[model samples]
Target: MKKIVLLLFFLAVIAQTAFAQVKKPTLMVIPADAWCMNNDYMTTYSAQGITMNVPDYKLALQNDIDLLNVITKIGELMAERGFPLKDLSSTIRSLEQSSAENEMLMSATSGASLAETPYEKLMSRAKADILIELVWKINTVGPKRSVTYTLRGLDAYTNKQIAAATGTGAPSISAETPVLLEEAVLSNMDNFASQLQMYFDDLQTNGREVSVEILTFDNGSGVNLESEFDGEMLTDIIDTWMYNHTVEHRYSVSDATENRMLLEQVRIPLFRENGMPMDTRNFVNNLRRDLRKAPYNIECKLLTKGLGKAVLVLGEK
Candidate 1:
């Protein structure tokens, strides 16, 4: 009897391990913005009368052989540890091919384009679960050389740094950036992987974090947060929908008024019912579609700024 109990326990443990291995988070490695600027791969982007300098990822990937080597090495290492990887250069190229003409989403009522940062555009295209930003330098001591490296794992949806590793490898005679980087990473990879796993575990338990905002168009439609349907204000109805849809009903209403509603720290599920990845836009679009039905019959426009924030403009598509 004791032998049978032990066998069952071992089988259960093996089953749990297999289950955990099935949904490893996908990761992509890119050079840090600081690294890009230092390497002279910076470009200007303008939005809403605000011009700012951002990393020129395409230029960097095309011109910097060392950057490509470093990214490939990190990707290989992470893949060995069972995490799926996305190639940054490939993603950029794919985006270029798909959007040959600059695609802009404009408001039908106002003729205004959606606001988006350069980084946001990249994130929306890449669609990786975690973004690994890497920055490295070579230290020369007399004739010997060493690598100083930093790796930051950011949650793609929230842009929050979940894990980080930084260190300098022991002085080596090798001058290859990839070789020195591999040495530095080998020393820290285990700890970094453990940290990443912990973050993923938390995500499985708590769901993804995202923000949502409800706005009304100035089209003179009698629809706003103050509008009532079946004796419940539009604000209350949306709040109840959020409560019912979010994972564990975890979300906070930061501000609410007749014109707008802001919801932050919203905990949405990681996947949809059919096992596809779920994002902020999809979640909000679900709400938008529901509101379009019988009792509400609301018309709304859905605009997503990046991976984590979505805006639904009510009272005009």
Candidate 2:
């Protein structure tokens, strides 16, 4: 009996250790845009003579006590299930610091400034694999209050919704908002987590989805997609490279022209050959390097937007 008990204890310990070794996707919780708009936490920006409203995450985090409490509770619950969260406030602060530093630096050769859009700053700084958007409403009926909550898991790379859960909690006369929010999510958390796992599993199998566009600088280099190299059109060479480099030749040439080419649904490997995490910039830069070699002998400039889109301009930097 003593020997059987000791063997069982060792097996249990091994099982727990294995479970802990399993990798979980990194996640971050943010108030959904609807929640931000409804709560009056929004800011506007002008781009190309058009004004757009976007969620003011920094303002929301600083001003809303209930929002902080709800995010904390949800993060704690996720951490218990092996998925810890990237805190939004901390990421925002870090982004601000980096932005300030970038503003003070310029290229030594051209004296050009760092050009980054606000969206790029946020997405690059967050660095989470998944963004969990949370929205909740306090419903009061005759002094009894309940919370109607929605949680959506979005792939940070593709901005696609992979999982969602929505429901209302049982009404309570005295329970606080955080307690109600916790109760609402607890019932659906398991299924929501399962969906997230399914999405991650699909990523492991199919690779990450992104978009790549090929363009040319109008700098009179006499280079375009039709420009021939080694008896093959430049477009064909680029297409062949994409077929060979992308995961399993999974990408589509949505549009191709003399001056521009757009490739969508481009599936790239999750990691590079050296086992480092791969992003849009790294993936496109590989192509840029390849094009610079041997018969191609092309100089290319790479630009990336957010985490999933890259534009490569050929013929000159």
Candidate 3:
């Protein structure tokens, strides 16, 4: 009997340790300022030559629904990713109520409004090691429409921004704006969570130190070509370079080339032409070379050492 009791205690201890090792708490805060637009133009439509205005209370109710959806989706994603969801539903409900009150108060005043409200207070009350703030915006330019969102993670106690992610979703002026918003939020949830996880992993492995470097370059073709590269050109370049060199070559079925040769022959020339000092003729030649070598394979490394991360942006020479 004594041996059996000891065995049972040991098993219980092991179980507790395993559980503790897997359990992590995270808090997600979506402020009202994160909403796509300060003005809900959808509520300002006119029908039959009579302008129809949405009541503040009604708008508040709708805002609560939107907030609830965002919070629920985030909580679900976190739970799926091995984070404890403890009391998330209740927390979401509380946030919804707070959001409703804030929207109501803001509806009354056009210019002057409360600096801080119950909603902000409640969000501030959420306690966790990591906190994520989600902000979204909707913009219309001519006939083009765009939706943008940003996810920022911060240390709860220190209030220091740890990690951030930004992504844009397809935009349309159709009646499905709300549905589009939900889809965009859900689509980016994994990325947002992954960034937070990376931050936490860094904190455990290294200290609190992170760095970012932005290297802007012309396409290296000196033809004065006019083409829209959008804002993802840098990421596209890095991804293509990494895929060809390091990732499996199943896509193109090619053996890995020497890193140094690839860097000098293709990558260095690009930087030298666009980033380094050079004469106009040399710049145009370099640009022409890069343009002619479109779809070239390049390789680069994103090295993170002891909280210092650097993206050694490389291109085909």
Candidate 4:
């Protein structure tokens, strides 16, 4: 009997390992675009010819404490479904501290500021596989309040909409927005999570989508991607880098040129060594490090266009 019990336990262990191999995508929950726009938590940041309208999560939280609770509650709901979550509030705090450090260590630019939003900075450090966005409204009628919510799960690596859910809560005596939001989500949270999981499974077999581009600076010192490096053009060297670094060697070259290269369909690992998720920036950063080595000693700036595309501006100081 004991031998049979041990066999059962071993089989259970193997089953668990196989399930874990499937992997759950890490998540980052934040206020939805509509909520931010309504609250005016927005800022424009431009760099390297790319511009983005990003949210000020910290500012939104400052304006309303319930916003934090709303995000936290949504995260809790997702967490119950076995997904790991990065706290946007905590990420904002860390960014604030980092910003202070930057101010102390460096001088400010005199021209127009190009400061990115807290959401953008948070996106960089969290490196979550998906970004869960929440938008909720509380309606009061006849002494009862109900919450209507729209939840969306976007691919953190690609900015694609992978899942969406909308629901209305039962009217309750409590007029609290957070409570209403939680109640509304609980009604269909399981289905929402299932849809996200299905999408993640697809991303696992196929690869997460992303785009990569290489461009030479106009003020360059005449050294472009066509320059010879180790008997091969610098463009060829970068192509080799992508082929070697992409997960499972899966990627598609959309276009290539002496001074520009466009690569799409990049396959990247879902997580890093420290358990943080990986994204386009992390993949390009690796290439940047390689290019800084002895033969190619290239100077460049890494800019992200949306969540999925990485731009490496070559020859920019």
Off by over 4 Å in 3: 1-21, 32-64, 85-89, 92-125, 140-146, 173-178, 185-188, 202-317
lDDT, candidate 1, 26-64, per-residue tens: 899999988998999999989989899999999998898
Q: After superposition, how far is residue 272 of candidate 1 from its true place, in Å?
A: 0.6
Candidate 3 lDDT score at position 48: 44
Q: Rank the candidates by TM-score, best first.
A: 1, 2, 4, 3
Model 1: weakest 10-residue lDDT segment is: 98-107
lDDT of 3: 0.45
Q: Which scores greater on TM-score, model 2 or model 4?
A: 2
- Arranged by lDDT with the best first, the candidates are 1, 2, 4, 3
Native-to-model Cα distance after best TM-score fit, residue 33 in candidate 3, in Å: 4.3
Give the Cα error of residue 258 in candidate 2, in Å: 0.7
Error of 1 at 88 (Å): 0.3
Residues 4-34, candidate 4, lDDT per residue (tens digit)? Answer: 9999999999999998777788898888988
Local distance difference test scores for all models: 0.90, 0.89, 0.45, 0.81
Q: Return the TM-score for each candidate structure.
A: 0.95, 0.90, 0.37, 0.78
- What lDDT does model 1 reach? 0.90
Tally clashing residue pairs in candidate 4: 0
lDDT of 1 at 54: 90
Candidate with best TM-score = 1
